[model samples]
Target: MDAAFIHDNLEIKFLILYIAARVSRPIPVEGMQELTLCDSGIDYFSFSQCLNDLVRTEHLTLSDDGLYAITPKGLRNSEICESSLPMSVRLLTDRNVAAYNQMLLRKEQVRAQVTPRKNGTYTVTLHFSDDVDELLHLELMAATRDLAQGLADRFQKNPEQFYTRLMDTLFPKE
Candidate 1:
């Protein structure tokens, strides 16, 4: 309804630092943008300038893959000044970061690969993992590329369900 609680470039930089510090892992520029641009005051141009400034100042690091992460310097400053951001903004950021981090973790845990076979069949390989263990890895044959891709897509969407259903099907109650 109103402009961002962030009033100026200083606040924008602080917000950037706050997000970089809070994220679970290094995030691409698009991810950073999603986290940092919630405020009306933080526009794309200003956000870009502040992000680049953080990199230039070594407050943050930009990887060759275009991911952004907080440096030690950035974290220290964020720890010191994060209290200055509005409580609402901080809470909102926390939620955004948590959701994005969960997505990242899921991406790391669930994986699917589709490969073409010489016989014109496709192989769909699915892997499901958790923090501690590989839950499952299964390979199945598909008649075509589309079928292989569809299976992979569905497996990624809910690997846990797929794994559970497969286990149940393999050993049903008598």
Candidate 2:
């Protein structure tokens, strides 16, 4: 209705497109929300609406796996209108995107889980994997949930050490 309202709406849509174009990867909705809504102070409802509108208008594509990627139309639009966005906002988006990328890499390489057993114990599973194969998969039983969680946390923090120690114990060199 008003000029300011229209400008804000257009900027929000452009910001979404700018982020998707810059990331150059399929980003989950939660990741986008983290960057736009949580980190950048964009209204959650507005962000969601813009995302849906982008997809509906074919500016962005949403995969069945729930990741969003910018379409060619979105990329072209962002390239043309990105200067309207403030440099500060662009820098903040870049930082958040880098952090999100690091988080994703860490998630892919290491994993831990704690499961409670019916026998009043817990099972802690620690896993380390690469793109093609699993490098390590260790399971330990702990008497208490705290202990189980602690083990899981330690494993996640330093899976390489655990894997090395396991190898050393299993095959001592002469």
Q: Give TM-scores for every candidate, taking all chains together and pairing residue i with residue i.
A: 0.93, 0.70
What lDDT score is found at residue 30 in candidate 1?
96
lDDT of each: 0.92, 0.83
* Sequence-dependent TM-score of model 2: 0.70
The residue-by-residue lDDT of candidate 2 on 63-165, one tens digit each, is 9999999999999999998888777777777888888878888788899999999999999988898778899887889999999999999888988888889
Candidate 2 residues lying further than 4 Å off, grouped into runs, are 1-7, 38-41, 113-125, 130-134, 138-153, 167-174
- Kindly list the per-residue Cα lDDT of model 1 for residues 11-95, writing each as its tens digit: 9899899999988899999999989898898889999999999999999999998899899999999999999888888988899
Off by over 4 Å in 1: 1-3, 118-120
- Cα shift from native, residue 127, model 2 (Å): 3.0
The candidate scoring highest on TM-score is 1
Clashing pairs in 1: none
